[model samples]
Target: MRKFAMYGKFKAHPGKGEALAEILLEAAEQCKSVEGCDLYIINVSEDDPDTIWVTELWNDLEAHDASLRNEDAIAMIQRAKPLIAGVEPIKLKPLGGKGF
Candidate 1:
């Protein structure tokens, strides 16, 4: 099966960037043990502290979708909801890369 990838940006409420990032980091850790989770990276931007970027790779699209429905993921989303001002997700078809 082809891999599934997503690049997303989460904008946090005023002064809540750090908190939001922390929560996302927790989610990353949880992904480590999840089936088909290849990568879950959290990044911070120096120019925009309120913007948290996530890069995810899964074994397939179904795996990525299932991860979203995982109980832990659901809880984390709820925890993050209040702090999230906006979200931008860009799905990608990764042809080839050093990381793959």
Candidate 2:
């Protein structure tokens, strides 16, 4: 199966950086037990503290898609919506990776 990856950025609303980060962290933890989730890393931008990044690796594109339909993911998205000012997600085709 082909590996799939996603890189996402979340810009927080004013004064909501910490809150947004916490939410992302919680979501990452929730995804830990999810099937096909290879990696779910949460990061905060040094250049822009209010900007958060998440990089997710999955077994395949279908695995990634299925994750979105999970209850934990749905709840996370709803809880995060108000604090997020913007969201950008990019899908990737991984050739090879050390961690993956």
- Candidate closest to the true structure, highest lDDT: 1
* Tens digits of lDDT, candidate 2, 1-100: 8999989989999878789999989988888888898899999999888999999899999988988888888988999999999999987998895997
The lDDT of model 2 is: 0.89
Residue-by-residue lDDT tens digits, candidate 1, 58-80 = 88999999988999999999999
lDDT value for candidate 1?
Answer: 0.93
How high is the CA lDDT of each candidate model?
0.93, 0.89
lDDT of 2 at 56: 88
The alpha-carbon lDDT assigned to residue 14 of candidate 1 equals 87
lDDT of 1 at 9: 91
Which regions of candidate 2 fall more than 4 Å away from where they truly are?
Answer: none
- The top-ranked prediction according to TM-score is 1
**Residue 52 alpha-carbon offset, candidate 2, angstroms:** 0.3
